[model samples]
Target chain A: MENLIVEGSHGVYFVPYVNFNAETGECELAGESYLEDTVLFYNPLLEWLDNYINKKREAIKFNIKLTYFNTSSSRCLLDILNMLKDFEDEGGEVAVNWYYDEEDIDMQEEIEDYEIDTGLHINLIPSTDLVKHQEDDDDE
Target chain B: MEANNLEKKAQDTNKFDLFKYHSLFNQNVQISYKGPFDSKVLSVLGTYIQFTIGKNPKASKKIFNIFIELAQNIAHYSAEKNLFGVEEGVGSLVIAEYPEHYAFSTGNIVKNEDVIVIIEKIELINSLDREQLREYKRVQRNLPQREKGNANIGLIQVALTSANPLDIEVTLIDDKYSFFAITVKVDK
Candidate 1:
């Protein structure tokens, strides 16, 4: 299966950088997500996940790192999380890691709320250590 | 008796002053969110608000949050539709600035049945002092999670973040739908 990649934009519609690999079963959505057309923006991502879960049924590792997102984006995020919840219910191996800025109290609370809303165990990772690791990767 | 009379006159003057002040600063920008509220439009407008109003971080943040929450509310809940061309909610959002603060206002057509619930929630928030509201939020946060799209925490967050109580006014547009208008203030 081919990987799905969308080159992110920082305009009126903020697109979150996405990297979904069918081979490695790794999906990452990062950056700010304030989309002009949220439903359209997220529909393909949902379709890809559904296809993977139904056909390939692989272990998926999902990572979310968003610094800022409007309330409209929050609804789309919930939809994505619910999809993942369903995938997990179907006996799929799923792990979600939510990276947030430690100092942003509102963001931390939002992550907690998402965990409550999704009923999926999400590891809340601080960005400091992750940034350092990413820097190391860039050096290599 | 004399003091009571003086107090009454003072109150009347205060009311007049408030009316005059609001009228003077009533210049507003109203935008309609049809299809997925264009994030590009939002960002550009948000930047303009920030630049035009002068950059005080707190004020800017309040305006941004208020705009996002109000816009999303319309995008998600507006009952009127123009067809499948755009899955957008029909609503109007207005941003007005006064010398002391900026007022964010949103109005949209909603089912008449939902008005009571919305009013009750706003009244509940208004009834609480800041500390109590904070505690209420904490309690809500601790409660077992509800289904997605069921959470009513947006208004609470708006009240808390803006440090202002939500002021809502509802008008009966027709038998089936009511126009709900909510305004919140952010100090400059």
Candidate 2:
């Protein structure tokens, strides 16, 4: 399967950067994710994961470092996590490391909620650098 | 009732008195707009508010989160659709500052029949604490795709983001329509 790479945009709506490397089994989503059409924006990435898990049947490493996302996009994130969880439940090796802003209590709680909702063990990493990441988002 | 009182009081005093208790048009008003709350308008307002609502980053984030949900709520559900044939809803939004907090409010018209259900939902949301609300959101999120109700979930997110009770006002315009306004505050 071909890899998926999408350069995120910060125009009238924020779109998160996505990169799913099929060869290496490494995937990442970063940046703000508010979008005009959240499902449309995320469906392709979900399909890519679908293809990776089904066709390759290999180890998967997912990294998420979003600084902000609307509720609709949050639902899409859940969809991605649920897909990964399903893959892992069927004996596929999967690891997800999630980075959150240290100062954002609500974001940290949001990550915790994801763990509870999807029954996935997410490695939560707190970083002060997320503030800097948001700065880069603004520059875009 | 609140809207009617505000109108009567404004006409009586010949000034811009608001809500009969608090003045939303005071010098602390940061941003105010009345128009179609489509995606483009929300994007511009969201960016501006994200950058310049208040000095506190935490508070600003809360306000921005609440604003997006409320604005989009108006965009999707407001009864007033003034964009010709499109569904771009029309509404009013305001952000004002207080020494201890920042208040964000959105006002729009709605079907008179919906007022009771809306108020009941708001009260139910207000009754829950942070933990309960989080649980509510989780269950709502995990529901099967076909049965998910996004409109209620939007308001739940708003309440969760602000961590405050929603101050809602409903005024009967006639037999068919009513003005619905809701406000939330973020502590600075």
lDDT, residue B57, candidate 2:
84
Q: A1-140 in candidate 2: lDDT tens per residue?
A: 89898877777777778888999999989989877777778889988999989999999999998988888888889999999999999999999999888889999899999999999999999877853222234443
Give a tens-digit lDDT track for model 1, residues B1-188: 69778669879886554454445443453332323443444566665664655466557756776777676677667887546466667776667667788788878889999999999989999999976776676556445434423235567777876778899999998899999999899887
Best by DockQ: 2
Model 2 accuracy (lDDT, Cα): 0.85
For candidate 2, give the docking quality class from DockQ: medium
Name the 10 consecutive residues with the lowest summed lDDT in model 1 chain A: A131-140
Model 2 stretches with alpha carbons more than 4 Å out: A131-140, B1-24, B83-86, B144-152
**Candidate 1, lDDT over the whole model:** 0.72
Point out the worst 10-residue segment of candidate 1 chain B by lDDT: B29-38
Quick one: best TM-score, which candidate? 2
